[model samples]
Target: MMKNNISYIDKVRENILDHLKTYQHSETIYNASKYSIEAGGKGLRPLLLFTALEALDTDIEKGISAASAIEMIHTYSLIHDDLPAMDNDDLRRGKPTNHIVFGEAAAILAGDNLLNESFNVIAKDKNLSAEVRIKLVETISNRSGQSGMISGQMLDIEAENRKTSLEELESIHAYKTGALIKAPVLSACIIAQAAPEISERLEKFSEVIGVLFQIKDDILDLEGNPELTGKNTGSDAKKGKVTYISELGLNGAKEALAKKVSEANSILNSLDELISTAGLRKIVQMFAERDQ
Candidate 1:
């Protein structure tokens, strides 16, 4: 189930990459854009959008547009995240980070380009109604902007080396991580014209899974092999960042992860009408159980 789920996700990512390649040009700006996009990751946000849209059996074309847009935004975030002022890591997904390949200025512009130009892809898509396009614009803007991932990053920077309550921690992550994570799922439902009740249930699933995603990430930081996780593992401890594992202890974080997995699976079970996508459910379960 896990292997097939990963293959399905890879196919979705390849489709998104094909769409992205259409926008590619020979310009240096285009080269920088390609660099970051090609940098490998799981493409989780876009996969979530695809899965949610499939669950509704909606317009597949519009769903592809939404998924591709989310990937652009996510790649933009990664480009900026590796800049000198941010994490300053020289490696990402087993390649030299974006800023290292492109000069710092080009890297910055590449990220900026991806962030701003993603809207054009959605707006120009013929499949979506104007109202859906507008709603997607609003949601993606909010999710990627000041009150969402950006704000969470700012809070993360401010709270570093300072004591933060568990509530404060969740607030930061909910915005920084959860906002983008939830956006793809919610945006897909909107594009699919799914009922409000179904959207809310999926949003709940996104919330819990997003939190556990980061929790497992923290655990992997402490215990994962660098080869498997594709990044240095000890940096979190070296940076003195407060993570679920750091705050709650390793065993405690594991217990919390188990509870989240159980709840998330329960939600999936409630949506059993789309039981054919059980591979996605199994993928979520693997996310909960992975060591790296």
Candidate 2:
């Protein structure tokens, strides 16, 4: 079931890639644009969007556009994050990072393009209702901008060389990593015009999963095999980057993650609407038990 769910997501992502490639060109902007989009990841954000939409019985065509938009925003973030001034990661998804393939300036421009183009993609999707389209734009902007992911990133960069309290770390992760993670799930509810109570519960579920996801990522960095993980392990410790693992220690981090997983599961189990969304349940389990 889990493997099937993953394959379904991959199919959607492949379709998204194929559609986006239709807009390709021979210019430098085109080259840099393709670099980031083609640099692959697990496409978890898009999967979350689709799963949440399925859980809510949202209009599938609209859900897919939103998912593609979210993926673009996510990919753009990764492109900028791998730049020289940021994480300085040379490799991503088993390929050279965007800045390594494209020059720093081009990579930066590419990131900007993807970020702006996400909205265009959403806007051009005629299947979405006008109201849902506006809400999605607002949700994406809020989650990815000053009040969310961007602010979280600033906190992360600053905390890298300093000691941080757990409270401070939580605030940072909630914004930087958790904002984007939570947005797709919650956005589905909003786009579907779900009940306020249901939407809020979905957000809460997303929060728990988001934090747990980051915690698991920290664990993978410490203990994962690099070949399967597709990125450098131990980069956080090697760079003295502060993370939940660093602040809470391995055992403490595991305990915290377990609590989060339990909380998320409780929410999922209670949502009668989600019982049929077997893919969503499998995703939660995958997050909890994944070694990388």
Best by TM-score: 2
1-292 in candidate 1: lDDT tens per residue?
A: 3343245555555654565567766477778887777776877776677666666776444676666677888888988988889878787776788889988999999888888778877887788889999999898888889979999888887877878888888898888888998898889878987778777888898888888888898888889887777678877777667788777899988898888888888888887774345745865876777754
Which pairs clash (backbone N, Cα, C closer than 3 Å) in model 1?
none
TM-score for every candidate vs. truth? 0.90, 0.92
Lowest summed lDDT across 10 adjacent residues in model 1 is found at 1-10
- Give candidate 1's root-mean-square deviation (CA, Å): 2.5
Best by the lDDT measure: 2
Q: Estimate the overall C-alpha local distance difference test score of candidate 2.
A: 0.81
Model 1 CA lDDT for position 223: 90
Residue 43 of candidate 2: its Cα lDDT? Answer: 78
Q: After superposition, how far is residue 71 of candidate 1 from its true place, in Å?
A: 0.9
